[model samples]
Target: MADPTSLLPQPNREEDPETPSNNLHHSLDQIIEQSEASFGWNQFLQSILVSLASLFDGTQTFISVYTDATPTWHCTSGTTTCNSSSDICDLSTSDWAWDSISSKTIISDWNLQCSSSFITGLPASSYFMGGVIGGLLLGTLADSSLGRKRLLVISCITMSVAAFATIFSTNVWIYSALRFVSGIGRSCISTCVLVLLMERVGRKWRPRVGIMQFFFFTLGFLSLPAIAYINRANSWRALYLCTSIPAMLYCFLLQFFVKESPRWLFMNGRGEEAIAILKKSALSNPNSEFNSVLLSADLLSQVPESTKSIDPYKSMKDLFAKKWAMKRTLIVMVLGFGIGMVYYGMPLGVGNLGFNIYLSVMFNALLEIPSYPLTLIILEKWSRKLSVLWFCLVSGICGVVCAVVGDKQKVIRIVLELASFFCSRTAWNLISMFTVELFPTCVRNSATSLLRQSYILSAVFSSMLVSVGSSNGFLSYGVFGVAIFVSGFFVAFLPDTRGGTLCDTMDEQERKESMILG
Candidate 1:
């Protein structure tokens, strides 16, 4: 076991005699690296706010399933036979008896059963495609001009407005267009929240903090079935309002509740403000001693005196400037594209299995509860590379199994789907953390945003495939199986990031592997 005392700075190590000041001479990350020990109240407070954003992300991610659901239908008394395989609405509602008392979904409300496939999948696909465009355009601002707090606030408010507008969508064209706008506006929420949450704590607490955010996200996903079930027979507008109202309220609460990160502030040369925040943190956790003067001096040495002059695009450009950095990003992006198909496709395709759609969605969401805790365990004790690789391979097999299970055996098919969901969730959760660690603090947001965009881009194509292949098991899960397994094989080429300190700058990240080897 490592010595507990080594975590703290030792007075005897080397005293740099003060010429005119008495202060610890280390960088901002160095100070946290040496001094941070426990998960403090300040970090906990920040996490509550960040995890709330994750809840919103989870809500937005699968909200389309509810709002755009293909509604339950029945045929009128002697008009025509109720053949589900064909459009039941083709016969005018006047001839066919309307089964339901109200409009159950956009699909039913607009009589889209006879609509083209592209038109049917447009809303969800456009939302994802918009995410790809939005993340690339706005996500960089978090690492540069806007900082994490403002970006999160903006994203939440944007999603709320879009959800509100969607309640009054006049046509499919209008609804699909608004979803694209919402996707672009709220695209930075997950990436910004993840980065801001981690920056609030020391490296030792990062894995725990990350898992905690995911736990909140899983809870959000679980809430959907309950909300949707309650309004299942009612107009889909009701579900949209339920999710939107709370999200709008959360945006307002953010102003009074959230604080900007001291690390980000200091890194940008806002030393005095950073010191003020650190003092608040020091008080919040009385056990941790914070020497503000010493920390401020360290901050001054690292950040240029004039932070205002820094280029806004510097962080984005830095991502491509280094060969290793570029390679690392490209390889991980390829893997993310594969994971994306399964991650988003699983729950969306659950209803296509000819089972009870509500029950199937709930069952899939249930597995996420255990998956996140299990992810925390793997992150702490196992090789991060192996964790991702093995989980991917296992999930792939589960997907293929799901494809082979006959529709007659619904229970067996559901079991394989749940197994596939479990493995995929674990792998995706770990991949989020692994990618965060692989890059430096400076461009971490941009790098992660890029990976997220890759995932969203894949979802654009995969969403269409799953929809068109709703009745064909092999086309959906089978394709997912092959893609994930291929990504798993590439994991062998990457280095294990566990058992080492997180790098705070690109230079440190570039030197990380060589230092570990030496």
Candidate 2:
């Protein structure tokens, strides 16, 4: 086989200004410069908007306000107090009235609430349950028919619309329903973006790009508080409205800038279109020699023979055909679920622990910044299995220590929480990369999405656990510790894919096996 890199277009080295190649080179340079500039600016703006979209969910902000209000119930400090005495009640003296009021607004009337009950936590947990279902349904669609770019666009638009609709909800049921829809859209967007980015970039860039996605996701976490501060006085509805605008705008912008995945095009038998895209990509490479047929051959070679005639559903069946793959799927699923439980549970659990919810979440989010760099260093310098094992073990140990501290020593608990945060973030980063590496390209997105649904599902369970553990001191932390410990066991099942090239198809794996034996 010829070197795949050679097939890509190379820059015209002939310096004669009169030559057609040189003229094309100059034009290509201009295009390259423009594309880079546009991509950077657009990504920056989108990052901010994405952060705002998260804030629209208002999980942290709403919990904080509802928890902190001492007098009349208001969504935030800046909210206009209900001037009508009829609307505002001093139900603290009456048990029945207090229960009624607490049901509607627990944060403002915390004295009447049963903190340790599951019912109190049902609203948030319901959203997560919706997220799980959404993830499974939409995630598969994202892997099969929609393609990553289209899935993201559609998810974002629907999420934005659902978010805005949440504002008009009069009761918890309506709010939960809208949140469920939004959760599904959010799950699809998150997974699709990962799939899209990994497919577009070269193998060498995969880990770095994977880390970059989480970095931006963490930025969304960091910015959530600030956005909440700005819209604190406004109705919670305003937050949704704010998030919707950016999502809708981005959907429009994506139509112009985002290209369909060439890999997907080829897999779907749209070979001509895929070839055209490759030609355009080659043309954009100022250092590449233009060769359309050569580029097409290289791209075509990446498509496995099995994939050529296989239906999408059949492709999924093959993913689990081998024992190693089945093991990989199970391990990834369990690990994702455990991590999701810890990650989502911590924020909501901490909120109920009577800490400053915003500050706690921000602190946790900040801890994630170091995770990507640490993962990069470990994956490059150490083994994937070792890195995952170390992170999960250490995180579980920290969780245990935190549980032992019992929130009695505020400073100690905070320090332990931060340490645990770091470990969880690192574990999650490794899991995402590891899962991506475990499957062939044909079923890569599908397998990863299915595995990730476990995470979303666990998130729902964790949220409910938060409501249950709210009143019991040390219960939530204790359970979280156990979850982290179990995650470490699951990590043992994953095969190390460190220092390996991304497998473009199952045929690549077969070839590797044959080469090893020969």
TM-score leader: 1
TM-score of each: 0.91, 0.78
lDDT of 2 by residue, 233-329 (tens): 5444555566566666766766666666556665665655655654565554445344534433544554323233345455456668876667788
Assess candidate 1 and give its lDDT.
0.76
lDDT score, candidate 1, position 92: 61
* Number of the predicted model whose lDDT against the real structure is largest: 1
Per-residue lDDT of model 1, residues 1-518, tens digit only: 33222344543323321111112223455455433446666768778877897787787778877777676665555544545554554566654444564477788788786777688889999889888998988888887888878888998888878988988998899999888988886788888877777776766788888887788778788899999989877888888788888988999778678988766776676767766776666665555656543433434554535345678768888888998888888878888888887888878888778888889888888889998778888888999898899989988998888888888888888888888778888888888888887887678888888888888887887777778767688888888877887887777777777755556567666555664565
RMSD of each: 4.8, 8.6
> Which residue segments of model 2 deviate by more than 4 Å?
1-116, 289-312, 513-518
Following a full C-alpha superposition, what root-mean-square deviation does model 2 have from the true structure? 8.6
